[model samples]
Structures are given as C-alpha cells and as structure tokens.
Target: MNVLITGATGLLGREVFRAFQKNEWNLTGTSFRRKSPGLVRVDLSQPDTIHDFLNAHLPAVIVHTAAERHPDVSLRDPAGTRRLNVEATAAIASWAATHGAFVLYLSTDYVFDGTKPPYRPSDKPNPLNDYGRSKLDGEQELLSRAQKSSVILRVPILYGPCETLAESAVTVLADQMNRLTEPTLAIEDWATRYPTYTPDVAYTILQLVEYHLAHPDFHGIVHWSGNEGMTKYGMARVLAGQMGFPVERLVPNPAPPSGATRPKDAHLDCSALEELGIGRRTPFAEAIQAILHPA
Candidate 1:
C-alpha cells in the first residue's frame, strides 16, 4: 500500500515516518522546509500544489499529521493558523475523497472545553482556544466531506524523547537537578492531559488503516491517547521519578491566567478505539522511561 504522510519532518511526523520505514511500507513523506530521503517538499498552505501532488501520488492512505499546533503561536497568527489548519485540511480531505483514498487526520484533545474530564469521541467539542477551534474545524470538514474514508484520531500532549516539548521539559529539570535547585513552579491546579508515545500513536494509525482495508465500511472519529490522566505537575513528577532525577526539583503552582487560556481538563476516553482492538493506552511510567533512555 502506498502511504503519504504530511509534516514528515516534525517530531510526531518523524516518528511516524520511522515506523512506516521500519515496516517496509511504500511511503512518501512531505515537509515544507527540510528534505529527507523519500520526502517531498510540499506546502500545505498552497492548495493547488497539494492537489497536484495528491493526484500524482494517488496514495492508498494519507496520514496527515501537519498543522500549526502551538497554542500561543496560533493565538498570535490566527489567520495563518486557519490557512494551514482549517482550509488546507479541507482541501486535502476533499482531494482524498475524490481519489477514494483513506485519510487519517491527527487531531488533539484541545478540541474539548476542559470543563469535563475524559472526553469521549461522541462528546460535543467546545474549543477554548484558537488552536482548538482550528483543529475542530479540520475535524468537522473531514467528517462532513470525507465521511466514508476518513479517521480523525484526537491525541493528548504527546511525550517522547524526540518531541520538542518533552525534551524541553527534560532539559529544564536536568539543569535544575544539576544545580541542586528546585524548579520554581509547576501547574498543579491546572489538570490537563496525558501523553502518548509517538511510536504507539503511529502503530495505532497503522492499525486503523489495516482495519479500514479489511472492513471497507469502517470510517469515523477515534480517540487514541494514554491510559491514565495527570496534571502538568503530576506528569513532571512522573518524569523525575522515572529518570531518577531529584523530585525536589518540582514545585507545585497554579496556571497563570495572563497567558493562553487552556482547558483545565482534556483527558480523552478511548472506549470506541478499544472496541476496535487498536487503541491500547501505554502506561505513563513506561513511556517516561522510554523517553529517559531511548534506544
């Protein structure tokens, strides 16, 4: 099967590319700037370019992991965010539908309002921020346009060794431990999301593709995330404990309201995914250890 993955140079995209490579799948990956072997430089912001590429490639599956994912960045440039996240996604979904190719769109837990915990796939989305709103737009576009051959997988805060945010957290804690000083603050009151190992998410995507191929009638939104939920402070503690870092380096605090308005709780329930036998939540500790000691 020929599979095309967009945003192949980003953290999650790179992991997905590696997984597909290991499986010896006929894969073509795309990036905007950085070029790698088997990668084509395609700008999602250009619908004509994207459409031409899709028509030429005619891939059996299109795994779209690209988007303006940063919440703050999205707030700063909402127009650009919509261009890439919403409009571009709609274009891709339309192209995929035209070609009769299965499209797996990566979504986020941010689609929830955070007023409720452990969001289900059936739950109505009430996005609190620009990033969430844009993603929700993409989800709706894909669902409404490519109803029969689309899968929307909403993920949480992804944590892995290669992930930029995860690595930043590790580096900050390590620096504090080296200095024998405690980190100033951790957002204890802000209950947010769990983390998904990149490889695990990629595996689940592959399973979704396989399921679609076999059933031929399966298509809809699916929730894929870690087994447990934790606050930012709790996740930090887990990282410290698993890495054998000094736990004293963590200081509990509340999220400041001056910055971006994040959902207080966005944990996703994967019961629908579990029913498919494709969503198995990886343990938080194990995921932490893997990040600490990547092989």
Candidate 2:
C-alpha cells in the first residue's frame, strides 16, 4: 500500500497525501523547491530525476499533481512550463509503465472552450489558454505512454487549506473583499465555474486507487466537479457575506482582459464519476464555511 505523490506540498496534493496517510498507507511525497520536512526534494522538471526517482521507489501508485498551473505564468513561460507539465509527465508515465506502477494524473476543467455548458469525460477538449493546453498535453502524454495503467481525473477550480488567502480561488475572493476600501469591487460576472474542494478530490483519488489495487486492468478518464456552478461575482458575494463584508460591495465586471483566453462556462458533467459511487460532491457553501471557520 505504498503511494508516491508529486507536488505533495501543493494545495491539492497536500490533501491527497494526508488522506493516504490517514488510511495508514506508506506514503512518499515529492516537492520541487520548498523543503517540507517529510517530502523528498525531487524536481519533476528534470527527466533524469523523475526516471531515477521512480526506478528507485517504484511505489504501487503515483499521483502526479505537480504542474505549472497559473494561466498567466504558463503564457509567460511556455518553454519552462512545458518542461514540467508535458515532458515530465511523459517521462513519469513511461517509467511507470515499465515498472508496473499505476498513475493517477490530476488534470483541469480549463481544457474546454466555454462555448459548451457541461463537458463530459468523452467530450473533445478545446483548451482556451496555454495553461489549459499544457494540461491537456500532459494528459495526452500520460495516457499515450501508460494507457492501460493510468487514470486521469479532470477537476475544476479547487479550494482548500493554504498558507495564504491568495492561494485558493474562493478564499482569494474574501481577501479582495477584505482589502478593498471602495464600496464596490468588480468580480468576473460572465464566466461560469465550479469550485471544488481539495479534500473531496483527495477522497475520490483514494477510492480510485483502492479500486485499481483490486482491478489493475481498470484504466480510463473520469471527471469530478462541484455540483454547483456560479460566476466569480456570485462566489465573491457569498464569500463576502460569510466574512461579514457587505454583499453590496461586490459589483459585476465584464471578463477582465488577460493574455490567456479563459473558458466562460466549463462546468463539468461529473455523472461518470457519480455513477461509480465514489464521486462525493462537496457543497461550496459548507466548504467555504469550513474555510472561514476551520474546526
């Protein structure tokens, strides 16, 4: 029951690490730069290190969560981001295939153009930004190299415990509301999105891993998203209210101009995962409450 997780210090990966550890599984986690006490310092961008790390540890399952995630950052440094997002993923998948390991890659909902309302696992991907394109490419690389042994979980905007408010999208709303002195702050009014909780995603991943352990032949793509969809403006209002900030302070804004083209309504059809009896959707309001008042 050994599981190795990449990006173990990240917002999502941390939850996965804790979930597996809670179940008393042997866990090895990797970090790129920040030296967390328990994480192994392995730069996934380096193919040699990835190859060496996998060959040496050869965990039963590898949860690949490390990536260049910011759309703006990806647009600014395509080469640097691709090295980690696409190339490193390919190397890990190839190595895992040869070593008889199962890989669970965490992907994003941004792979779709917002023209579509609800995207399914079978739907074609039409990414709107370099970040999305890079993530889609990583998905392709892993599946191509390790088709029979890997599972791709396409997720939506994630929020969870982080060192700072700026780290999670939902919390960032509260941060903005807290800092703004003006009576009104503009929030994205047009684009529709689903905000998912990180711990719920970790729960889904663990279930998939348990199934994989029993059925090694099981391999395919599935998606998990929060059941609710709201525009960023709506989310801002909700978060503002919870934080005791006046809901009137939030104002609607047209989609902000950005170097990256973002999807307007990429709400995922998580029915595929739901049918599996493992995709437990978390309520956004409840998750926000927990974040606002962690017990």
TM-scores, all models, native as reference: 0.91, 0.97
Best by lDDT: 2
Best by TM-score: 2
- State the weakest 10-residue window (summed lDDT) of model 2: 249-258
Where does candidate 1 clash, by residue pair?
Answer: none
Predictions: Cα RMSD each: 2.4, 1.1
Please identify model 2 stretches exceeding 4 Å from their true place. none
Q: Write the per-residue lDDT of candidate 2 for residues 1-295, one digit (tens) a residue.
A: 6789999999999999998898887899998778799889988888777788887787889999999898999999999889999999999999888888899999999999978778988899999888999999999999889999999999999998877889987788888887897878988887788889999999999999998888888898889888788888989877887889878777798865457888888888888767778767778888888888889
- Each candidate's number of clashing pairs is 0, 0
**Pairs of residues at least 3 apart in sequence or in different chains that clash in candidate 2:** none
Deviation (Å) of 33 in candidate 1: 2.8
Q: What ranges in model 1 sit over 4 Å off?
A: 163-189, 256-258
Clashes of 2: 0
> Residue by residue across 120-200, what tens digits does model 1's lDDT show?
889999998999999999999998889899989999877555644334333344444445533454435466567677778
Give candidate 2's error at residue 147 in angstroms: 0.3
